[model samples]
Target chain A: MQQEQSIAFKTGMLSICLFILLGLLYLPPESVAQQESSVPPGTAIPDSIQLKPPIHIEVKDTPDDAGGSVTIRWEEQPVLENAVIQKYRILRASVENSVPGEFIFVGEATNRATVFSDGSTDDDSTYVYKVEAVYELKVDDTTVVTTTVQSSVSDEVSSSAQWFNFQRINVFVGVVLLSFFILYYIYQAQSGKKLFIRKIAGLEAVDEAVGRATEMGKKIFYIPGTQDMDNVQTIAGVTILGRVAEIAAQYDTWLEVPVSRSLVLVTAKEIVKEAYSKVGRPDAFREDQVHYLTDDQFGYAAGIDGMVVRERPATIFYMGAFYAESLILAETGNSIGAIQISGTAMPSQLPFFVAACDYTLIGEELFAASAYLSREPKLLGSLKGQDVGKALILISLLVGTILETFHIWQFSSLFKVIGE
Target chain B: MRREIPLLITAITGIVFVLQYFIPHAPFNKMNTWFSDWFSIVGAFAIWLGALNLLKISFQKIMDKKSDWFFALVIIISFFVITIIGFAEGQGFREPGTTFSWLYDYVYSPLSATMFAILAFFVASASYRAFRARNFEATLLLLSAFFVMLGRVPVGDIITGFLPQQYQLSQVASWIMTFPQTAGQRAIMIGIALGLVSTSLRIILGIERSHLGGGD
Candidate 1:
């Protein structure tokens, strides 16, 4: 059975129509005559033929790319007097044996967008694209009118890899400049030049913390973070672990490292074993010392929390990337009254480490820890080189901000690396 | 020979990758993909090293009756249970209705979420300790924390609704975050980037060997 339209809704709609007609009566005689000839409500008023179909469709291979992309552009057609354009849908198909039915929806754009990029196309394969304008002319809340007009299909174009990404020239220059400075400094250091590095409180306390743990006869917990070996922070953490393992070996303090990633486990195990061997205490290094926890973040945190509670390590070192679990691990170590030293380049997690740990290595300090502990001249040279690089960046940022504020220049783009 | 082999591999691959960033042509692009593929292959196999080690320790603890032997037993049991079901069920184990996925959803997921939830209490406790005013910097931190905390909740609007827009606590909090906090974060990020560059160069040149567990 068909549902009947409500009498109240019909009456309300009629009253609205009567109100509009009454308003039209106050208009000038010429405008009133025009209004009388208007189409009835909820009727399809065909748009004028003057609204041109989209034309001048063009497709070009995306520049500065290793193939597999095409950028499409076309002239967007104007809308009729009352017709609204919702969007432009892009369609693509193989140039050979291509039919209108074979075209696939490659992407969509806003009504105002004049271009679309399709990156899914294969290299060396010719393809064609068509742009369709989708517009909606709604007569009322209960009725909507939609229409589509397709542009002519674009000519077949093929994508090929470029030899060099010219857009990334800025990145190339920056890398070369930094490498020059580092290499020059390294050469200088090889000639017996001493490099000065500022003291880091966290690094300086390594010896004291290890001694305390040794004297207390309790183990030290070394968490190289919950991240895999691919992270640069984990690499930094593992290097520091090398230094710490040596200290623990020399002091004869038992060390335990719980890891989440299997690769980190293998890497950390090898580093600790080598550190123990270097200190002539290879017998003291146990294979079980560097244990593997589940790769699940919270599961790893739970394992550490339970171990920290039960065994109650004398000292804990969190020296890598951490996320939401940073505070949980730190606070638990705090509750056990263990001296905690934490370090991470994660700006968000730095505050939690600073709040809960006895000493915190913020940002670059974690990367500098191994060099600081080792005190090798060549390594110290790189620190000096890094300082110089930082000085240059600081100058750039200061000048860029002031110039941008006063509109004296748009200088920041000099440091921007496109296609990076 | 052992150290030299690793160092040689590191240097050759690192330089190639640095070049790959600027060169989009063949060979370099192909090498980058090849390198990443090799990394994935090695990573897949590296899991066995960790799993075997984990089992060795767990078994040792249980057989020798060391401390926390029950936990070791639990780890062993859970590991085999998951591994066997995963191997047996293959792709079907990932189905929502299957036993493996059901165990993951019911047992593992809830336990993980609970552990994450515990972080909320830990954060409160940490903030409490951090807020104690012992010095000038500490006092400043405490004051900032007070405004930031108050501005985050509905009561802040109720308390400061009478004030002008600029002087309101919420405005102050937003200003602090947009300017000072953002500035500090950026500075750290810049420093980290420079440090990473320096470290990467050191590694590629074999000047930093502590990662090999020794200071050259």
Candidate 2:
């Protein structure tokens, strides 16, 4: 009876396995038939059904926030071309880096033909790109598709440079005024000119925040944003870190900097070391205090959020190029009841910082904050120069607006001349 | 001497660059393009400086063996690996079956999308916390934000009862964006522009050397 039962069970399991195998085999044939009926790759179409090549393949010029991507654009062929053209296949070949004539297919578009972009190429790379028009063909029993590849590649393009557009007429006026002020200030500095800038309420609060942290024996948290050292805001943030470190050193308080960017970590370390040296507390400046987190945006945020919660700091300073993480960090700091002062030039993230933090630096104020904290003549002169430039712009806008309002067409030309 | 040389270069290049914009002749335009190209070359060099700085810190962390040093090691390893796979091999993962290309398209793209998706949850939370009717201004903001958000989604038209042909929700949203959002954004933008102009002037004139550090 046991042997009979085992035989029956074995037979049932074998049938079940066979059914699944047959089902898998049956499913692929339907998909294969469907694929076979559709147009296949490299199938040549009739010459009568020709499609126009891509038009005006223009590469975009923009700032490279992250060093890897470049955007390429092209105008769509006419609607007639679109009907015949099944899809647009963008083929990219590296002219400089790869073996002489190797081309790679980076992107494709079946529906949207007008614009296709390729980030497959690196910024450091010089690439030659050619787009082709793929045409669909209906044969007796099968369909064929063909691509009329462009004869020559598009002009070699490179990433845009880091040069600021300093050539605007408004900026010209600004430069002149700023130059005058800078020269005057240099003379003033030589002649012992007394330069006075009002004390920043935020900076003034720094000492108290440090003292409170020292009293409670809690750490002071400093985040120098996620941006690398190239960004000016990060530099400004690190400068403020120097000041905060000095106070921490003097008060015998622990100051910790968790930087998102690796370069920022190095710079913040040096700045902290210098501050500790100046305060004669070099021994207290631990290399471990300033450390690097991951370069990944959210990964760094998660690390910082963990640190903020686990080690509840008395004061939290967020300054630099922050994005979505600003709110995450700021809200977490607020919940901890830590005094949070945040500053960033990123316009989109500014509102979050303002809503969540005790004090927020709006655009230029973040730049000026470093100068205000440092009180050096050179830095102060720059702040004054910035003001003069603002004055020039204000005057230009006022004059331009009034002229355009009064329908003085000839004066408009003068304004345009100045504008250029 | 230190001050004079920088000042002279700043004034000459600054004035010429600005003046060239007004004069649109071949020579001036070419000069502008040339200036931009030179700037790119310098920018490329700056990338090396940044990358070096990045490696220095991460390597130091690995050597020190601090807590969470594994993250630092991962960063350094990934950095060099990607750089090699991308530039050295030149068959970036998008190039068919290369390891780097596969990692980039499947791993990097999805990871990027995931990071961006975090904004949805954050927006929901932030809106919930901030969109309260505490005051008149807050109420107005809440109403506009609600309308904008609602109109963007498919359910917006459903809620508004088959939105009339003339008073389309999309048009209203566009109008709100154009008039109020544009006006406010432009005003902030103008201030930012002026700020940038001033900052550049300061940099060129050597007034804003804080970016370089406080001293000569």
Candidate 3:
């Protein structure tokens, strides 16, 4: 009887121990949280207790600039009131051939920050980005627990250098249309089609001015402006110089060209030499005639003024781009009783030239000088093409105005030079 | 060969530059920057060439004892002195404490400013000559100038104070600028643009070769 009683006691104890183990295994999650709270507050929380990952992460390439940047944006997922986010950690991975490589820690932003620009990317590369929300819990200002939850990786984005910008497509189209018209007219001109160009008083006076200078036995002064050869105005002035030089060579009149830029001086020397050669008076061509003055705007003006006062040329040509010194030069020329012909594309300086000079080639008339003087078929054709372009622009403006007046705005937007 | 080579180079470069405006690709952009750098280098060389030419001309004039040779001598001396100082001191020549800087600040700046200041007097003279109502166009220009000048000053407002706000001189001036002046300016600009396009096309196609000394 004693042996049987002992066996029963051992069995009962074993069963009780099994019941306790089973109870602990199936304990409610609230009791587990309570048990955890009963411990020291500084204890580390398990991974399951971490904050949720941020939601709706977006990655896109930056636009309208040299390609090298990607923008990453995200918002935090919903969390309990007590959840404290410390910061967000950003990671970047290079994507190659639709496969993502290992991610490297790129940068970090504060907890409240939701945007980051990854500017360290190479041009024409693909990339993926990941954002991690870092949460931190502090106990008694001494111990702290930190955890991180990573957002879903953004879709692959390939950054590429655009070969053509569609935003400026309107400008491109305009250029193409104008070029087509110019080329078509050029072909027609090459086939010996006659075209008419209006008379430019400033250009027509070229012969008169050279003739007067020859008759008066006084030199002719030509100032090809203050800008360098890169300027279109200077190029136009040089073209005019060729014709004037030819006239001077034919008339045996001394022609002086005082230039502000060295390149212009060289170019003027070449043009005059060629002109004299063409006129069979190369012996009259003087290298010293076309000289370089100071590149300073006012210095050139002062030099020209001195020349006007002392040498007292019979005629002066102020052509190409001018700034504040336009009136200064033109007035000084006027004061010397010299007939002045001026041309420039600069609108502000045009009035000054017009006010002081005998004849002023206003705006496009300056560009038209070569075509008018040379009367080359190709040049004449280009001039006619320019008229066509002007007519087109005027028509478009009228149509656009009428359409906009009727509240039909979409038609005008087609001509917008910028935006998507 | 000379003409052909130059024309070919010009055509290629012109087309490339036009394409560069539209292209944002790597090779084209790189080429554009390379060309720009080359242009800057060429510009520096051109400056040197200009300085050398000036020195040669001035020296010749001094030797020949030409008219105003003394001024040429002064220019040469000034040029050499500034160049030497700039070279010796590097960028310090532009600093305030340097002799070069002092010359530029006190001498050059004042001389340039004086020349610029003389423009005011010249403007008055030119305006007097231009506003002489010798013709109908001159009379119209004079009237426009008068209205613009009057409207720019505060006295114009006081003179037109009795008139309606829109009829005031300032308002009238604004209307003239906003409509007539703007219209004229736009017409000029459009014409200039068309001219530029045509001229550029002629140049690229080698039709306008006067700039290269003669026509093709």
Candidate 4:
């Protein structure tokens, strides 16, 4: 009975000790902070603890661009020159009723950076921004201390869509002026005013090539290039094709067009049919004459080469946009002893055509071919309008060069293309 | 009626597109994108029309036992096989290991590369004919081509090693390309741009109607 009483006394003591330990664990954290502040004298306080935030934080919508972006800029604090700043953190908050909501970390820039472009915002939405300068203080080999002090919150700025970019005003003016000149000349021509157009040898040879094919009793092959109707060069090529088809209908010669684009094929068919009907030979018009070949570049070239070898056409007309296949098609036509006439606005392919074909239209001449061949007053007047435009460009270039030579840059700057 | 309707449509659309360049307002920009989408959709339909036309011609040639009818048969069979493989395999038809991809990699790719390779021979022949020095202009062209060819290779450096680096063949070639060639190219581009603008104006004003098949 005496030993059991001694054991009960020891258990009571142990329960009291356990209660004391749990009480220490649940104590308020402020006491610990108070104790740390009560450090003994002569201890050094780190300089990073006194670091200041960046100054003059500003945010606004970026100018001269398609919207949906805001630019944030700030000035570095003087303390940054002495302190070892690691980086600056940019924080963004959505604005509601003139108040910033919960701040979200947007991005980080290096210590040297003073600008940041925030491209994540929605259009027509207001946003507030802040920049925090971060400083690191290494206490030991294993522990590095970091302190981030944020600047004054930026003013609310909203990204909004812009109508008619002011940056492209130069281009707009140029187009307006050119269109005015062209329209004026066209009106004059319509009113029966005669306009002179220079003769293009390549265009003049079109009739000769068609006649040669007719005399030889051989077919004429017309390729309107490999590109679709979207290309201006291809459209020009089809315009030339219309004239060629008319000649073929009149001469009663076989005309074939193998196109690489579906739209071109349909357009070519309509054009050929119309040409025959215009010549009063609708009976001779065949829908099967103009057809679509493969859209593949080399495949189209191979197909044309095979046709040239097998059918041995007397004349071949290549008028359109071409790339590497230009040389291949031209050389094959030359080999087959055909009178090849090629026209393209592709500067790179011009050399190949000139080298291999009997007649070649150099750049602008290809675009001018239809007007020259048709001799329509409206088309002739347009050519005169183009000459005036050229004269204006030449004068501008000469003036710009002279101004630049004399260190006068304002005139040249007027021609600068913006928002590209 | 046919001519008038088409001309009206052309004028309206052309004016809209031209104005689209200057106006970046919401509805104007939206309309520009919508028109472009319509063109793409119409182009898709045109592809079907073209395919049907091709089939009609090939089938007729096969029936008539025309010369090279075997090629027509080959085209028909290949088109069906490829189309079937593409449809059956879905989007993965173009993936590596599929039949469509295998045909493209082994057959179409090689044929394309072969045709491109033939350009080297053709260039050689064309250059020979062009560089024949038949006349004064031809001789000038030949000289320029020779200088360009020589400057583009290591042999040029070795041949002109006696000159200073600034006056080296490659340096001269660079100068030619940068100055004279660029100037000439810019002039042509300017001319082409003017011509394009004038031609487009004529079309938009309904003054040029040859493309509508010689209509008044």
For all predicted structures, in order, the TM-scores are: 0.83, 0.58, 0.81, 0.86
**Candidate 3 docking band:** medium
Each model's DockQ? 0.57, 0.09, 0.58, 0.63
Question: What CAPRI grade goes to candidate 1?
Answer: medium
Predicted candidate 4 versus true structure: per-residue lDDT over A1-420, tens digit per residue: 999999999999999999987876665442233233322344343554576778888888876545777899998656433346788888887886433345677799998899998878777578888887776654445445555667878998987656776777898788888888877887798899988787787888889999999999999999999998878788889988989999999999999999998999888889889888988999998978998778889989998998899899999999999999999999999998999999998988989999999999988888888889888878877877788888999999999999999999999889887756
Across residues A1-420, which tens digit of lDDT does each residue of candidate 1 receive?
123457777788999999988888666542343344334554764545333457899999988888888999998676566567788888888876555446778899998999898989888678988887776655556556665667877898888889889898877777788888888887888789988789999999999999999999999999999888768889899999999999999999999999999989888988999999999999999988998987889888999999999999999999999999999899999999999999999999999999999999999898888788888778888888888888888888889989999886658777677755
Q: Which stretches of candidate 2 lie above 4 Å from their native place? A: A1-170, A181-204, A260-266, A331-337, A376-378, A406-420, B1-94, B102-112, B133-137, B151-172, B200-216
Candidate 2, which CAPRI tier?
incorrect
| Whole-model lDDT values for every prediction | 0.86, 0.69, 0.85, 0.84
Off by over 4 Å in 3: A1-66, A69-120, A128-154, B88-91
lDDT per residue, candidate 4, B26-107, as tens digits?
Answer: 5666778899899899888899877888888889889999897898898899889989989999988898999999999999
Q: lDDT tens digits, residues A61-132, model 2?
A: 333222344566677666553236667667677777765555666778774656655645566778777666
TM-score (C-alpha) between model 2 and the true structure: 0.58
**Residue B120 C-alpha lDDT in model 2:** 70
Which has the greatest TM-score? Answer: 4
Candidate 3 structure, TM-score to reference: 0.81
Kindly give the stretch of ten consecutive residues in candidate 2 chain A with the minimal lDDT sum.
A61-70
Question: Number of clashing pairs, model 4?
Answer: 0
Question: What is candidate 4's local distance difference test score?
Answer: 0.84
